[model samples]
Target: MVLEPIYCPSCTSTNIVKHGKSTQGKQRYKCRNLDCSRSTFILRYSYLGYLPEVKQRISEMAINGSGIRDTARVLKISPTTVIEELKKRS
Candidate 1:
């Protein structure tokens, strides 16, 4: 099996280890980097990302001239994916 690198969302560090599962059963990871402030994180997409309302909101935000970070913060998606989606729409 191939292992994919898991990065800390806060520090983008690859020095992470499996901590445990969240209460919701998602896999949680712990950052080993001393400089990293975040202790644990879940690597799965949030429930909000799957909602139709959020999908629509992303498009609406794009149409309103919101940047990728703005849409990602408001709709809770990755900025790279947001840029890709907006590129396809344009």
Candidate 2:
């Protein structure tokens, strides 16, 4: 069996344990990094889109003068998503 690399989106910590399943039957994982802000995470699109890496990329692209529409197009996400991410960073 292939082992999946589970990481804490907040701190990028791979020290994680199976937390349980979500109500929707998704696999949940708890981060072992005490310094991490996020406690648990589910490997899903909705959650993945909100990961720190994604957020950082959003900021980087924005700072590089990328428009929200262009960022969304390149990121394969929604412009609303780009806007929301920028809002959070600001």
Candidate 3:
């Protein structure tokens, strides 16, 4: 079996521990860094829209003149998600 090293998304600290399971049954992790702002986070997100990389890509696609429907199709996410991300940026 391969062991994966989990890091805190906020501080990128490897000092973390298993907190509990989210309502969606995803594994939750707690950051042990005292200076870290975020307390708990999930390593794997079921929704593509919730991932930071996807959000960044959405912004990049928009900047490159991709429409909402095109961005959604390329990212395999909802057009509403693309719209919301753009709204948040503005």
Candidate 4:
């Protein structure tokens, strides 16, 4: 078996360790970097709203004059997800 190194997506640090399993049984990882803004993250997310590209699209759609409902509809996510993302961005 080959061991692959895991890097923190936020800080790009290779000081990551297994935290636990998620509700869907995916392995969750925690960053050991104290200065990293993000503490934990999963490499692959099952939900569209949880993906980084989708999150960026959420903000982009909002900035491009798309309403929350439209953004959510186009992204196939919930309106609450768009709202929450916008709130976080602001």
TM-score of each: 0.50, 0.69, 0.78, 0.84
TM-score of 2: 0.69
How high is the lDDT of residue 45 in model 1?
44
Stretches of model 3 off by over 4 angstroms after superposition = 1-4, 34-38
Q: What is the lDDT of residue 18 in candidate 1?
A: 94
lDDT per residue, candidate 3, 1-90, as tens digits?
Answer: 999899888799999999999999998999999999988889889999988789999999989999999999999999999999999998
lDDT of 2 at 62: 94
Q: Which of 1 and 3 is ahead in TM-score?
A: 3
The whole-model lDDT of each prediction reads 0.79, 0.83, 0.92, 0.93
lDDT of 1 at 28: 86
Candidate 2 C-alpha error for residue 80, in Å: 0.6
Error of 3 at 36 (Å): 4.3
Q: Of the pair 1 and 3, which is ahead by lDDT?
A: 3
Candidate 2 residue-wise lDDT, 36-71, digit = tens: 999998878454456667778889999999999888
The better candidate by TM-score, 2 or 4, is 4
Q: Write the residue-wise lDDT of candidate 1 on 1-90 in tens digits.
A: 998888898799999999988778889899999998878877774566544456668789888899889889877678877776667667
**Candidate 2: clashing pairs of residues:** none
The order of the candidates by lDDT, greatest first, is 4, 3, 2, 1
Q: Which stretches of candidate 4 lie over 4 Å from their true place?
A: none
- Which pairs clash (backbone N, Cα, C closer than 3 Å) in model 3? none
